[model samples]
Target: MELKINRPTKGVELCLDLEKRSQWETLEARRTELAKDPTIDQRLSGGPVTEVAREITQLEKEMAAATVTFTLTALSHREWSRFKTEHPPRKGDKGDEALGFNEETIFDAVIPVSIVSVAGPDGEPVEWAPEKWAPLADEMTTGQYGDFKRAAFGLNLGEAAARLPKSLGASLVMARSDES
Candidate 1:
């Protein structure tokens, strides 16, 4: 299984290359390999674990390619304002600053994430979170945040990733932003 991960410093020196691969390749590889393994061999089910690993590698690569979304904290008054303007969540009642993730105002920086896996217990396949995700929280103090234990979190990463082409995660992100 080839995988690419997002490391701010490319944390790991060694890694696999799965470029020139498509979703169909991953989908087909697992399907074909598993179909051929009728016994569902423990060593090689080529199921979710394998598939998610492959895709996470791919996601890391894709997310790493992002020219934007770099993590920053301790911004100048101007930089902080600019960041807020760019990621505005919603409009204020009137004469208010745009709202969005303003973590920089408080925290050192928003952690740059690289989603690796979100599979099921069997590791067959499920909804996957993108490396760049708007996480949900239990409290509705501000934005829409989901918990890792939430039912929505149960969707395996594979299923989540498979929907990337259709921008399901994007939908979730926008909604999350609005909720905040």
Candidate 2:
């Protein structure tokens, strides 16, 4: 007898697990309620609420610094070149790469040049565009940009197979689902 194994045609997806994310909100609400309760202190309740509250704080911090994964469909070499040339790297005060521009700029440029998509909490893929990212990118602090830069670099480098590690890399993967 011959047995057949079914394989799921895997595809790249990027998005927060909605149910998991909702836990953060739920924790916040519980913390608020605990704070409002009277006689809910270590002295009376053996610090159960206090311990839970502390856990919530730690979880919130983790959420803030969480490394979100993004799947980017790279652009073609021709489009990549145009994007880099259009957004030339700015020189620093000492004629070096500008502060917060080198990696940050590259990551930001990747958005417009690539087809970036994210998944919903339900694991549904949602396509994102440069316009959707503009406001968030514009408001990011240098530290936040650093986080984004690292993630973007990893996504592009690994997915593009470093063919064009620099700004002008490959973009032919968009025609099909290819996850590196």
Candidate 3:
């Protein structure tokens, strides 16, 4: 029987390319030099120092992009809707009514998905087709899901992903993937 197993994994690394690293290093040096300048007055230090700091930050981000690898997953329609509702900055211009998630909420959701790793059954890995893991992820109990969510919150998204089933009653699902 052809089968596939989806799992979550923890931890990721950010890599930087040589050119980006050089730019980041130059910015870092500029920032350090600005920080040590004794002649700069607090009032006048804002513009120059702030500009250098911002450029440094931008370079750092560019470096991370050059080196870090992030995974992307396609969310099901229902999942997408749920995510949007749960983490929101709804597209409306109502000053009094603000129903939306800030950076923290977005990170909470993104970190979890970014760490998910799907593997096929002892074969070439395939894209985790929709409706496969969704049913199982849905079958998980509320508390079990909470535990999983907590892991994601802690930024320990995918490590020891196998333990998910033990937390959720495995018997609930007849089988993870069905090949008819």
Q: State each candidate's clash count.
A: 20, 3, 8
Candidate 1 shows a clash count of: 20
- Candidate 2 lDDT trough over 10 residues, lowest sum: 7-16
Better candidate number, 1 or 2, judged by TM-score: 2
Which is better, 1 or 3, measured by lDDT? 3
lDDT of 1 by residue, 17-47 (tens): 2343355466556656665765666466565
How far is 139's C-alpha from truth in model 2 (Å)?
3.3
Give the best candidate by TM-score: 2
**What TM-score, to 2 decimals, does candidate 1 have?**
0.20
In the range 24-88, model 3's lDDT, one tens digit per residue, is 77878887887788876546746677888888888766655454332343344465457656766
TM-score of each: 0.20, 0.42, 0.32
Candidate 2, residue 43: the lDDT equals 62
Where does model 1 exceed 4 Å of error?
Answer: 1-21, 28-38, 44-71, 78-180
Residues 2-111, model 2: lDDT tens digits:
99533111123222223345776787787678777886764655465666677777765555444344455545556656655665657653322542234435667666
Among these predictions, the greatest lDDT belongs to 2
